[model samples]
Structure formats: structure tokens, C-alpha cells
Target: MSEQNVIASLLDDLTQMQSLKTALCIGQDIAQYDLNKKIQWQYFNASDILNLPFTQRYDLGFVVFNDDLNRRSQLERGQIIVKLRDLWAKHVVVIAPQGDDAFMRSLGLTRIVDDALQDSQQTLWQFNILSYKNTPDWLNSKFWANPENWNKFRW
Candidate 1:
């Protein structure tokens, strides 16, 4: 199967495809997954960097690293993990060529598996930002030391 197809199929299995409401597609090629009518996709090519910072936030983001010579550093695109999560989306997914575990981890994304596409010969590596929701209890009003309850409330 083609590399794109393999990535798309794997995405179907890993995520609740129907639950995704919006996405920021960082590469022209990766943007092809827009076949899903459920998502409001904002597309951009690798070389276009200036407009990326202004893009609306999305539920997720996608990028496919390519060796295209014209691309402005595949890792520094119109979009890491786009360095995208926490900026453009709550989560991010990537499809890149194999062999950059340490480098990618430095960017805050983790591999989904060792062999992302077992049958495909292309050897694409899939990565995602494994994030934990931080709803800090101390930050919540119910747990806060409100001035009105200063004497009445006990630790």
C-alpha cells in the first residue's frame, strides 16, 4: 500500500476519527487526509511559515516529513509534536521517516509504536504528543483559599 494510505489507515485505528472536529494540516501532502467531512481543516505547505502562527486552534494537528528540496526544513514548517500542540491544537500527530527517536522526543512527541506500518516498506514513523490533562486542584475555585472563607475553612 502507498505510504499515505498506510498512515491514514493507522490514524483511523489510533484515534476516534469521528470525534475530531478540527485540524491544522502542516504539509501540502499530509493535507490530503481532509477526505473526512467531519473536520474543518486549515491547510498549509512546508515553506509557508509566516501565516502559521495566526491559524485558529484545532483539536489536532498533522505533519508528514518529506525530503522535498524546496521544503523549508521539514521540521520547521508552516507548522512539532509542530511544536504545534499547545499552540495550534491540543494534540498533534506526525508521519516521518524512521531514525530520529531522540530528536523527536526532544520536541515533546512520542512514537506510537516501533513498527508503525508493518507491511509497508517505506518505514514511516508515527508520533504523537502524549499529554496529560492538568486540571490543578489548587487552581480550582472550590479548593482555593478565598478571602471570605479564610477563618472558616480548615486545611
Candidate 2:
């Protein structure tokens, strides 16, 4: 499939993980991509993202770094990621070229995608957002902590 199509598919997959009430697509186009209707998607660019106000209004925020748009040094990129995670959205997804794998990991994000597509290097890197812990899975679930009694016990 085409690179754009592949990226679009990846985005679709992410929405399935959880019901996102809203998503903000920064420096990328989502109109061509079919996403979950349950999600309200907004696309925009800021000349100065660092100085933008912190509203934490969106459920998810995407920071797509491209040469034509949203170009910045690694340090700047790190700062933007922090800003987005802390103030702009509850969850953040970063889409960028394959660079140092450790960079995103160091920032507490997990790499979720690496694929090649038509007419381009086909190599892309996707990082997951920080997962905040609101509850423990075992607290109310009817399952045991040990596998021997997983089917018959509750914590």
C-alpha cells in the first residue's frame, strides 16, 4: 500500500485501542484517512507550539514532524512532546522518521510501528503515549493473581 495509506491505517488501529472522544492532528492531514466516527478529529499547526496555551482539552494529540512542516531539532522535539503530554492532551502519539530508537523510549514512549510502503523509504516510527494508572486491573476483576486459579478466584 502507499505510505499515506499505511500511516492512515495505523492511525485507525490506534483509535480501536480505546474510545477517543477527540483527537488533534498536528502538522498532518487526516481528511484522506478514514477514522472512527466516535472521535472528533481536529487538524491545525502552530508557528510556535511551545508558547501555545495548555488546555488539555483533547483526548489524543499527534505530533507529526516533517521537513515541510513541524521541523525542529531533537531537543525542541522533546520539549514539544512533553508539552503535549502534560498540557495539550491526555494521550499523545508521535509520528516521525526512523531515527534513534532510544530517543522516544527515553521520553517514556513505546515504539508501536515500523513499516515500509510504496515510493518512499517505507520506514516509519510510531511511539505510544504515556499510560496513566487510574485503577488496578486486579482490584475488581474476578481473577486470581496466580495462573493456577485464574479461572476460579477473585482478588
Candidate 3:
């Protein structure tokens, strides 16, 4: 139920997805669990989240937020999530401490954790782009959907 264990479990789940060919990990390095030789995994600093290139999109993105390390404001964090959602083809997984539920919800991420990890303080959230596309009224007014903002979204 420790932070490392929680991350390992999430990595295990992500690696099991056959459709996941590439992944971008923001805020932490997750290359040690290269379970799939075919999967291309890249790590980047949290600050680079907005500056990443847009030419190539990843199948999945992992964003980890530690209280002591990620001190960005709520609005800044929301922007990061929005940008990641736009760049990811399938899904974006956000791992943060429990207090971020409201902020995560505002960014369109759904908390998918069914049970709490015994001694863990982190929570897992998922934003499935495909599902978001199908949902009614969810994407129409979101800040990221505006065509004019697309240019600014590019790094």
C-alpha cells in the first residue's frame, strides 16, 4: 500500500493492455517496468508537460503527483490534465493524493479505484478519450475543445 507499490500495480495494469504501444510518463520515471518490449515508454519532468511536442501522440499517459514534489496550483494542474487529454489517443491515468478528487473531476477524469489500498494515500483516475467523445455535452464547452486554443496547446 506504499507509494511504490501503488505505482507498481498501476504499471502492471497498464503493461497488460495489448493496444498500448507507447506511453508518456509525466512527473516520474517509470522505465524500470518495461514489461512489454514492444511498448515505447518515455519519461519527462512535470514542468515539461505543456511543452511536449504534438506531432506524435501516445496511446497512454501517466501523470504522477506527489504532494511535496508537485506544487503547481489547481488551475495549473487542470491545464496539464487538459493538455494531456488532448495528446493521448486512448487514455490518461492520473495518480495523486486523495485530496485532488474535486480538481480531477473538474478536468474530466474519473476516479476508477474500487477499493482503497491498505496504507496508501494516493488515488488513481482515468480519462478515456474515446468515452469522452461519446458522452453528451461533456466536450462541447470544455476549454480544450476550442479550435482557437489548439495553437496554444501545442508545445
Q: Pick by TM-score: which candidate is best? A: 3
Steric clashes per prediction:
1, 2, 0
User: What TM value does model 3 have?
Assistant: 0.73
**List of clashing residue pairs for candidate 1:** 80-83
Collision count of model 2: 2
Pick the lDDT winner: 3
lDDT of 3 by residue, 1-155 (tens): 36665666666776675477888887777666554455688877767766766767888888888552368887777777788887654689888788877888888888876454535767889998777656556556774467778767675
What TM-scores do the predictions have? 0.62, 0.67, 0.73
- Candidate 1 root-mean-square deviation in Å: 4.8
Which pairs of residues have clashing backbones in candidate 3?
none
Worst 10 residues of 2 by lDDT: 118-127
Task: Estimate candidate 2's alpha-carbon lDDT, on a 0 to 1 scale.
Answer: 0.65
Prediction 3 global C-alpha lDDT:
0.74
Q: Which ten residues in a row have the lowest lDDT in candidate 1?
A: 121-130
Cα lDDT tens digits for candidate 1, 48-77: 534445546777677666554224554554
Better candidate by TM-score, 1 or 2: 2
* Candidate 2 lDDT tens digits, 1-155: 47667767766777787667777777765645655466777776645667777655787777777674445667877777777777777777776656545777777676654544424542344433445444588676465355677677555
